[model samples]
Target: MRRLLAICVGIFTATVAWAGMPNVTFPSIDGGTLDMADWSGRPVLVVNTASRCAFTDQYEALQDLYDTYRDAGLVVLAVPSNDFRQELGSAEEVREFCEMTYGIDMPMTDITAVTGAKAHPLYRHVKSETGFVPRWNFNKILFAPDGSVVDTWGSKTTPMSRPLRDAIEAALSGD
Candidate 1:
């Protein structure tokens, strides 16, 4: 009985330790690496983006959100992905287009897979935690300061939508 109890305790401890965000890293579009762990203490808005998708215009709103809330501890991370086959062929092209078109200066990851067997580690971790995956470009996943998923929105949800903004505000204010 004591051995069984000990085993159960160990399992509980291990599960608790793994409850939060996955420790994953991705190559930044500009340079160097992006370690999700680095943003541990700040609320992060992670969006899977595609340069050519119809919803790509949301980049403007994303930048606006970043500009509006970054001062309040919101880290907006734009992760360019080709899972939907709408992203540009190269990171440089993506950078040029985003910069010239929307003047986007937020942090972005290189072309990544947001779904399927080749999904990025961060996406996989998100799926494990929330059982949600990007159905298309512009899907948003909001993470709390502690690295847990606070909320998720589908591709049709605009970055500036009231629900998304409210959630970001709540996460920032610790509501």
Candidate 2:
């Protein structure tokens, strides 16, 4: 009985540890898959974006953040979401708008649902792990190198905001 109990506990712990970002992936907007495994040793900033939202301009800040920290092993993943009904109609439209309007070049996922039962698996995992659902477009979730939630920010928290930048710096430094 003791041995069986120990095995069960070990399995439970492993499951819990693997339940976060590392276990999820999404369809990359460019092509193929965007596996979390590809970003295994880096901190990732996962942002839910909307091309037509008031906060859409945040894309430029996000790009700046990506350009500044990507060399330090940061992955800024843009997930275009329409859960708030503020996104373009299709992934193509989103891609064009982001490129043409903001000159964004970071990795982006196809239009995805960031809330409700139809939310993508990654967002679902994020909600399960941190109880954070994107309350509005441009909400950000930062993950540590070990695939754990580091911090989350609402729409108003721009990418270069003090809190968000501090968290990214800390995560990159493995703090």
Candidate 3:
């Protein structure tokens, strides 16, 4: 009976996780908080970024994507993480670097942990629900307007990649 109960609880947890996104907030690089709930009616593309990674150049593509689809309710959220040991020394530095180097205008978070026990609540929830973790910098997680996980891409997947764009298109169109 105890074993059965455990299995049932696990099922319930997974079901709840699949139903919606975790109520998580990020430490906005601009100060204060960036609540995920605020983007409820928009598709969000979350990318874990590192300033010094080889994939860092993808920031330009990410900005272009935001510029192109933002009017259609697409939100590109840049999460600066030093989990892979490549981010700048501080949030101020990260912000300055991103704005000056990449011309980024999208939302961004401070240098937060994106792996292990110290990972942000959103990352933890995603890992627990989908077993998806950022293996390296620039890992992307696409979320539907309803807050469900749409798809994910690894470090090499550019923001303008066909597959990722298709997923975003679907999410925006409510597919």
What are the lDDT scores of the predictions, listed in order?
A: 0.88, 0.87, 0.90
The better candidate by TM-score, 2 or 3, is: 3
Worst 10 residues of 3 by lDDT: 14-23
What overall lDDT, based on C-alpha atoms, would model 1 receive against the true structure? 0.88
Candidate 3 has an lDDT of 0.90
Error of 2 at 155 (Å): 0.3
lDDT of 1 by residue, 1-175 (tens): 9999999988755443321534367799998988777776689999999999999999999999999999999989999998888999999999999999999998999888889999987788889878999998999999888778899999899999999999999999898
How do the residues 93-166 of candidate 3 rate in per-residue lDDT, one tens digit apiece?
Answer: 99999999989999999889999999988888889879999999999999987777888899989999999999
Model 2 scores a TM of 0.87
Off by over 4 Å in 3: 1-22
| CA-RMSD of model 1 | 5.3
Clashes of each: 0, 0, 0
Q: Pick the candidate with the highest TM-score.
A: 3
Which portions of model 1 show Cα errors greater than 4 Å?
1-22
Q: Which scores greater on lDDT, model 1 or model 2?
A: 1
Supply candidate 3's per-residue lDDT for 38.
Answer: 80
